[model samples]
Structure formats: C-alpha cells, structure tokens
Target chain A: MNKMKELSVNHLLGIKYISEEDIQLIFETADHFKEVINRPIKKVPSLRDVTIANLFFENSTRTRLSFELAEKRLSADVVNFSAASSSVKKGETLVDTVNNILSMKVDLVVMRHPNPGAGIFLSKNVNASIVNAGDGAHEHPTQALLDAFSIREKLGDVAGKKVVIVGDILHSRVALSNIFALQKLGASVKVCGPLTLMPKHIAHLGVEVEPNLDRALAWCDVANMLRVQNERMDNSYFPSTREYVQQYGLNLERLQKLNKEITIMHPGPINRGVEITSDVADSNQAIILNQVENGVAIRMAVLYLLASKIKNYD
Target chain B: MSQKQLLNSSEMTVTLQRLACQLVENHTTFQNSVLIGLQPRGVALAERLVEILKNDYDLTDVEFGKLDITFYRDDFRRSGKVLEANTTEIPFVVDGKRVIFIDDVLYTGRSINSALTALQSFGRPLEVELLCLIDRRFSRHLPIQPDYVGKHVDVINEEKVKVNWSEDNKENSVILIDE
Candidate 1:
C-alpha cells in the first residue's frame, strides 16, 4: 500500500489550517496511538530525544493533563508552565516568556491561552512547533480532532453523520473547531442552544441552527452538549439554570422520547442536571470518557506528527 | 531514476519458500514463535510467510502481527518531513516467545532498532531475530545484522532498494534504483 500523507503544517493552530487529507492522516495516526496506549507498556520511543514545553496561559485541568500525558507517553521530556505560577503573573510578555523557555531548547510548545489568536501569534514568533490546546473561543484543534475520532470510532465514519452541537455555541472553541473539522470530513453540523447563547452567522459556517432541543435531538445522529460557561458569561444568556434545563437540558425523559438512538457527547465538566442529565451522561451511548481517552492518543499523534518537522533532534 | 530488477516473482517465491522451510525446521510448529512484520512494506513479506507457513507447510498455530516503527525513528527531526504512521497490531503477548522481525529491506538497521524498542510495549520476548528480504551490505549505521537474509546486495549511498508485492502492484520483484 502507498504511504499515508502527513499534515503539511508545522503548527496545529486550528482545524481550519488543515485539509481533509491532514484530518484523515491524523485519525489514522491516532488509531495507531490508541492501540499503543492500550498495550501493557503503553509507551512509544517516538520522541525520546525531543523536548516539549506545555505553556498554558489559562487554567485548564483536562487539556493540560492530557497534553502532558501524551508528551510523556511519546517519551518526550516535558516542562509545564502555567500562568498562575509562571512569570506571566509577573506581567511578562508572551514572547519573552516563551523565548526564555525556548532557550532551554524546547522543540515544541503546546499552548492554551485566553486570547483567540494567542497560538497563531506564538507560531509566528516562536522557533518551535505549536499545538493549540484551546485558544480562547477560536479553536481547540486537538479537542475537535479527538471528538471527531471518538465519533468515527463509535459511528464508523464522520461522513454523512448528523452531529448537533447542543448548548453554548457562542463561547465554545469546541463548537467552532468541530464545525470546521466535521464539515471538512463531510458531517452535517447543527448548533442548538438558547438564542442568546447562539453565535450570529453560525449558519454561514454551514451548520443549521435548531433552537428547539427536541427537534434537534430527534433529527441528529449525535448530540454534543456544551457546558454553560458561567465563568465566561458577562451577561445573562438565559433566564436561570432551572429555566435553561427545562428548555434545553437533555434528561432521561427527553432522551427516551426522542425515539431515535442519538449518541451523547460532552466536552466534560458536564453540568450534570443542566445540559445533560446524569443518566444520559452515563448512558452507554455517551462517549464522553472515550473522548477523554482518545484525547491522549490524538494529542500524541498531533505532537509526534508536528514534531517530525523539527530539525536536528538526534 | 533508473531501475534494475534483482529478483523476479519466481525467484522471490523460491527464496520465501526456503525461508519458510528453514523457519519450520527450527520452530517445529511455531508453538512459541511469533512473526512480526514491520509496517508499510514489511507486512507484505510477513503476510506471505504466514500464509506459506499456515497453508503450505501445515503449521496453522503460528501467531503473526504488524509493528510500525514510524515514531521510533532516530532521524525523524532530521528528516524535515512528517512520516505518517502505519498500524501496529500485536494482539498476542510476546513474553517468552521467539519473535522474528520481518521487513522488506534492511539498510541502516534503524527500523529494526525501532522495532526492538517498539516491541517492548507488548512484552519481553525469549529472543528476537531479524529477517529481511534484501540486506544492503556496508550501509548499516548501527551494529545490527539480520539473522535471515534472502539477498545481500552492495550499493552506494545514492542507490535505493524497492520491494514490490503482487498485492500492491500485481507483481513481486526486488529492484535497485540509481538516483
């Protein structure tokens, strides 16, 4: 057989920066890593000589841990830098901080920042490869990749699948990334949430906006519930948590009434009784943990593939 | 690129049969021996060997798997090009088993080195052996040699070895390309 092509970009800034072939390549590589991670040793000496720095300007438990675990699994040395403890607290510029870290000969930088284009900005200035964990609401490319991967694993293919991303579209980096990735791979996407929480021109991105939770759930093959970011909400997106749940929350009753078997997905920190009920979240159809499990493999593939472009790492 | 055929289908078949008979002579039913093919190219030879061992030689109990060493390459960063990974599917345990690493060509033995490191994820084997279709002599950068080699060819740095299988290109041939 012919060799599978690798992603062309040096930096995994966003799903928008990659092509369909790149996405296919990533999924294929992730398949291998997933199998490797399940093995007894659960480690590959792919990046043994490479050094990586995880620079998260924003607080993130899952993404940070996932990237670190992935880096470790690939046998790459990793140094983690978080804003709460780093010089960023001392008001150091992003460039200066990363440059100082790069002076230690870090071959790659996996960053998560509150600013939308922080990763893109660093990729332009930094000498190392950049993997965007989550850059504001712009894109969490790895999350999107893992999400698609989980979908592919569960559904066989992302192509021709009806994926409705329910709840909080406006402030969701996952929604945007998924939209780009799923569409690129031939999945018809829909965004369903309260009107206030929905982003304008989302339909222009080729995703349908179905505000009716029942209608969206009944029409889709999968329902991806997004967390209501109470921390990020500056204004009232909806009346109250109870009201939102009553309208948009996916409960056992709502799920059973749908009559169609739709896979449930949550990016985690699931608002248990809010966006998705405990029963629904814990259902066999819910691949939330699989998404988390596939996250390491996907991140490993991303790091390993991107780090392949780094020079002279004997 | 200029191509010169080294081994055609019939010669390739005879060599593979010889390798299989030799393996049977030593393994004697493949009770504790597992065959691992290096991914992409090596799998073709490994698949053929497994088929010959199972169908022709009547040894149906041999275990076979594919191992990809894309991530284990020492020169990945030096290449400046991203190498896509192939599947590594070793479903059985390798602990205390005689493992034979199969590949289409062995030049620098870097892939075999990577395979050795990669095989650890499965388990520690009783012993590991390298089997290659073509062994390009004097090109190895490491102190490694194949235990079973079908053909040994002397080639300079500018030359390339191409192994094609019937499954891939409707023919089986080993060719040398001068660039």
Candidate 2:
C-alpha cells in the first residue's frame, strides 16, 4: 500500500479523515505496544514530561480512565478538567473554556462532549493537539481504535472478517467509529438491530444495516455487542430487555449456532442479561476484557504520537 | 574493517554459531537460565542456539520463550501496516529467572525496550540480558547494549539490514543494502 511509515504522527491527529495506510499503521503499532503491556514497569519514556489535558465535557468512567491511564503510561503530565459540577455550565462557551486551558500551555487536549462537532470546533480554535474522546455520537475515534485492537487480537486480523455490531446503531458513536475503522482494516461490517435503532439510510457510511439478528449472527466472526441506550429507547428498539434477549440476547444456544471460534465483544457498563448473557460474556471466546486493556495502549499511542509530532513544530 | 559490506548466507551462519559459543561462555552459571526470542527473527536465533547448545554441551533442557511485542512499542503510530502478530507463547515465569532477550540485529534497541515492557505483563524477572546477531554501531539512538554480540560493523543509517531465513537469501548471513 506504499504505507507512509516515515510521516510524523501529527499527520494522524484526526481519526475520521485518516487514510487506509494510516489506519494500518495504528493497528500495527498497537500490536507492538500490546507486547509491552507485560513489562515490569509497564511504561516507556516516550512522551516524558509532556502535559496532556483531559477536558471531559460529558460524564464517563471507562473512557476517562482509559485515556488517563494511557497518558500516564506514556509519561505525560495530565491536567484533568472534570465538568461534573464545574464551570462548563456557568454560561461559558466550549471555546472560552478551551481557550483558558490552552493559555496554560496544554500540549494536547482530549475532550468529550454531548454536543456533536464540539471537538472539531475546539480544535479549529486551539493550537494544542486535539483528540475526540467522544463528540455527541459524532465520533469517538479512540474507542474505535481499542475496538479494532480487541477484534484483531482475538480473531486474528479482522480484515475481511465479518463483524456484526448488534444494538443501538443510532446513538452509538462507537458504532460509527467501528464502521469506519473496521472497513479501513478490511472487515466486512454490518449493523443489526430493530429498525428503530438501525438508521434507514446508512449505506453512505459503508455498512450493511441488517434487521435480522439470526442472519447477522450466523455470518459474524466477531459479534460486537453495544449497550442499548435506554435513554434513546424513547421510540422502540424492541418491546423490552427481556424480549430483546429472547430474540437476540446471545445465549449459549444462540452462541453455539454460529462459528465456534467466533468472538463476542462488548464495550462495558454491560447490561447483564439484555444485550448479552452472563455465560456468553464470560466465555473463553469472549474478549470484552481485552478491549479494556487495549484501550490504554491505543490512547497512549494516540497521545504520544500527537504530542511528539507537535513537539517538532515548536 | 572499513570495507565490511553485505554478508553472505554462510557468513551469517558461522557468525551466529560464534555468537552461540560466546553466549555459553558468558552464561555458564545458570543451568536454568531461559532464552526468550522476540518474535520473527529473535526466536530464529533462539532455535539456532538450542541446536548449538545441544550439540556442544548436549544441553536440551534450556527453556525458550517467544515474545510478540506488538502492543509495547513507543512509536506505534509510525509502525507499518498492522497484521495479526504471531502469538507470544511464554509458558514460564520471568521472576528470578535469568532471562536473555534475543533478536536478529541491534540498532536503536527500541524493540528490546518494548519487549521489556511486554515481559512485565506476564511476571517478574530477576535479570534480563540480550543477545543480538549484528551490532550496527553507528545507528544507536539509545543507551542500551547487547550482553552478547555476533559481529560489530559500522553502517550508514540510510541502509537497510536485511536478514534472510535459511531457505531465502541463498545462505544465513546479514545483508546490507541501500535504501
């Protein structure tokens, strides 16, 4: 693919606009980083003394912890701005809050917000490197990276592999990011759920929208189970969690109907029996935990590359 | 020598055998010391060492491990197209075990650096050492050193050090070619 292996990581700041070659490099690099997770110190001084700011505009646990741990592992000084009860609401704009943080010489900014395009808007005004943790279901690029790393780790290379993402496609920034990443990495991706959750016209996003769970599960090499947003269930995704499980809960018998080597993955805060069963989630074939571990490595890579690339500019 | 250039297949094999001999002299203390190869070529070196150790000292009990340092590299963003890495199949503990990290060539030692990070995810280690096939002295960007070196040569940074397997590259030596 004539991969530009020599380009500075500054070239990869925006995940949504990345090329096929850049996506390939992230996966390959994650493989290298994954090997080092077993080390005694569990760190390398790649981005030593660099400062990274985590400006989470939304409430989170897994995504925040993942980026924080990733920054620490890369040896960057992290400045966290938790807006749980803070000044994001006191009539201050995202640009104003971001500009105040930028004035303090933040090397990179990792931001999450309920507003779509907030990260892009902030990045346009700031000189500091920007990574979208989650931008109102528009794109959560790093989450997608971890998902790719997890899928590739468990089922070999997910390229050309059939990955069925079942549940909440409309509100899943994860689903959007995964569709982009999986397609770039050569996975044949499909989104399956009730018509309410599955958007009608998303072929433009390069994924097949399958309404039938049985057919989707039958062909999937990796079944990525996303949490159905109960908040977004205002219309109808199905009757209820019990009904959904009965039809698509991925029980042992349902799991057995597909490939024995098929892997079941979930980004956590998992609903115990709704989208996935207890036995199925904990199965030897499941790599839900691997996704968590890979999350740190991917964020570390993203931050290190971004911060270091910015270093050459100044 | 200033004129040292591309090494042929036989030169690579003989040099590797000499490296094996040197490893025996330096590590004669531990009968239980483990030899772990970083994936691809590192394990190839380890396999060669096992055959040599068996023939010379008739020692076959020396344990070997394979490390796939895919997730441990620092400059992961610049690494090439990703593929499913070969599995890291270490079945023993590294804590208190005399461990030797082996690879094909030593340049910046970043791969070894990543391997060190990866080893910790498994268990602890008493001591870690390295054995490399070639030392490209001019290209070092880190303060790391190989415990055992096969051959030291001065090389340009723009050049590629291509190490071929037993079947390819005609023989088993290190070949230097321009980028």
Candidate 3:
C-alpha cells in the first residue's frame, strides 16, 4: 500500500526528474533485490515475458554489463545493440535506429548515449520505458543510486551527512547525478576540484564549491572521487596529470591526517594514481567494489519496477 | 465499506484451540514439520498457532518463518499499483520437511499457488498444506482447498474477509466487509 504512493514516475530518466519519495522507494526496492541476488537461485520470475533492449551509443563495459546481468537476474529477455556496429555507422539517426529496434516488439529500452538529453529525446518519441544509463555530461542515475546505497549501508543513512565530490565536475555525468541524488536524500553536497574543471554557477544548484581538496576531505563524511574524464576533454583541463594528482589525489598520507574515518569511494575505472591513490582504492575504507555489487541490485529494482508499469504484460 | 461481525473474541479463542488440537492430532512431534506464514496478514495467525503449539501442546521443535509472495503474484502489474514487498525470513532450510502454509483468509487460491512457487527457492519439501482462519469455500478460482480451515464462509465477489487479532489491537474477531 505504501509503494502505491511511492515512485510516481515510470521512466527513470534522471535524478532531477524524480522526487524524494521516488528515490526512497527505489532504495527500499533495491534492498529486496539485493537480498534476492545473494541467494543461490538469484533469478526472480517477475519479468519473465518482458523484453528489454540495451542501446549503447557510447563505450561502456561496467554499466552495460551490469544492466544485462540485472535484466537476466529478473528473467527478462535481453537484446544488446551497439551504435558502432549497427546502422548508426551508416549515418542512421538516433530516432531511426531506436524505432527500428522497437519494431522488434521491445517493451523497455536502457540507453547510454554520447549527447546530453539523448534519453529525454528518445523518451518523448519512443513508446518503451526509457532508463537513462548515461547521457553525455548530463546524468548517470544508477551510478549515483549505488553510490548513495553504499554510503547508506556503511554510515547508516544519507540524511545529514556531508559528501565531497572531487575531480572533473564539469564533464562528469556521475558528479551531476550524485549531487542531485545526495541533495534530494537530505545530504549536503560539495564539489571540489581545479577551478577550471569546476562548473560556473554551480552554487545555483545549492552545492558549495570548495577549491581546496584538504578542506573538502576534512569536512566530508564521504569523499566520492570521480575519475578524470580524459576522453571527454578535447584539450587539457589542467596543466598535467602530475599536477592534478598533486593537487586533488586522495592518498594514504592525507587520509591518515584527516583524524576521522571518512569513507573513501570511487566510481571506477579508477585512474590508479591520478584522482585517488591505488592503496586508498584498495583499502578497507574503500567501498568501490560494494558500489559495483549494489549497481546490479539498483538496476534490477529499476527494471523490475518499470516492467511492472508496462500495460502489455501478459 | 460496511462490515458484519462473524466471530467474537471468546468464539475466536475457542476456534484457535480447536485448530491447535487438530494440528497436534495430525502431527504429534512436529520435529520434521515447519510452519510458514504468508506475509502482510498471515503472520499474526501463524504466530498465534506457534505459541499455542509450543506452550500448550509442548511441541517446541516446530520451525516457523515468514514468506513474502509480493514478487511471485500473477496480478502485480495488473493490480495497477506497486505492492510493497515484505520480509521473507525462512532462516532454516525446508528440505524434506512437512511445510504448512498459513494465512488469515483464503479467497481465490492464487496466493497459495504463488507461495508454492516461492517456496521452491528454499528447498523441495516432503509435503505442503494450507491452513486458513477463514476459508471462502465457493469463491476459489483454482482447484485448491485448505487442509485445515477454522471457519467455512460463503461470500459473493463484492465482499472481503478480514481477520483481526488481539496482538494487533484490543480485540480478536473475524468480519466480512462488503465493498
């Protein structure tokens, strides 16, 4: 009965598109899915007849595979589509490619694209339930959810906790999604990075801009170190990788001096020695692997819920 | 919604005693038998039975757990509203054990079918039985019947059966609600 009032939205396009209640519903649902996946028989027959298409216009190994595993665990039929090997190589538009895929009777679409608002555009034009995996520097909702889930599991709750998002904030979809999700869940968010890599007018989003990494680390309950997106940048955002590591990298020495047990998190493909040191990434305090494990459950909850709203399910 | 009382507090107490004695007569030791309550509403009935079986009948070895069938329901998407999932806390395995599925009311028999499907995750049981406080005998959509029924009820499609316990509030009663 409580779930009937929670999660008002069917499509999880972005954190900005969902309310605080919706986030709580997703987290609670994810808790159930997490327990289900831990069992010997991980498969749930909830979405047995539902068919899902994973559309990836950009490169992704972790997020793409995680969604597929989640779909399989829910007993949903899955089809994978990549833009590089598909008709997009022959100059087919995003709408044309997706519509053609939908003609095969796909009920849900999990899309990851290079352009911002690509998911929003497809959702407006397509009939299937749209889950935005990642859209340029816009949002990656599931990553942020798993990040929050890991934090909540470790520190007990997200409310009234301080989180510092460090690294390339301007080009990271992860940072944008994390800020929206954490703030909505009652956590105070701060972004710390090089001034050139930080977005202007970010304070308008109700986030504090802390240029000093030391102060940010000391003040936060959790330090979510985002990867330096080298592929997204056409030119150098900072002078060099050496300088970036020297200024913003989270290492053992700096962590020991913090005088508190701050949870260390990184959305992986870790740069190793750049945004965070290898020792810190592998330390007991790091919840990077837990984020990956929670990612499957989060996506499962998202898919299971959206599949429940499909009108044609038999 | 308007409701009509079916069983009062004293009558409900007598009914539970009868059901508990019936359980003891069927399974004496209860060493290899386990009790599972369907979540959301069935839990209270199962807990009462467990207490009576252990305290009065001295069958203390009986295992009890809660099984949530929210995900296994056939009408989840058809219900048009997302149903909240409850905890499924079957701590011990059910392999080769006599499993009794308990619920407050049995209506269409669809929930028992889903519970059977959900119970497969734990392990295959030697046998399975259904026990309900109120059994709507004529309204079953499937070829299923309860092994132990406290009261047999005849109701139309527009009516609902509600079983309230003293554990939840001050009174214990069964009411038939007209929708």
Instruction: Name the top TM-score candidate.
Output: 3
Candidate 2 chain A: worst 10 consecutive residues by lDDT?
A1-10
Q: Interface root mean square deviation for model 2, in Å?
A: 6.9
lDDT of 2 by residue, A1-314 (tens): 11234223443334567776766656666665665565555765556657788888888999999889888877778889988777877878878888898888777888888888887777678777788888886788888888888877776787889999998888988898889888888889988887777766678878888878888888888889999788756676578778787866777888676665678899887988888889999989889988899988787666655554564332
Highest DockQ, which number? 1
Predictions in order: chain A TM-score: 0.98, 0.93, 0.98
For residues A1-314, write the lDDT of model 3, one tens digit per residue.
Answer: 22464467778899999988888888889998888887767887788888999999999999999999999988899999988898899999889999999999999999999999999999999889999999999999999999999999999999999999999999999999999999999999999999998888899999999999999999999999999888877877899999999999999999998899899999899999999998999999999999999999999989988888887744
Q: What is the interface RMSD of each candidate, in Å?
A: 2.8, 6.9, 2.5
Worst 10 residues of 2 chain B by lDDT: B76-85
| Model 3 lDDT per residue over B77-128, tens place | 7777778888888888888999999999999999999999889978899999
Q: How well does model 2 score by local distance difference test? A: 0.76
Ranking by TM-score: 3, 1, 2
True contacts kept of 3: 0.41
Q: After superposition, which runs of candidate 3 have C-alpha atoms over 4 Å from their true positions?
A: A1-3, B168-170
Considering every candidate listed, which one attains the maximal lDDT?
A: 3
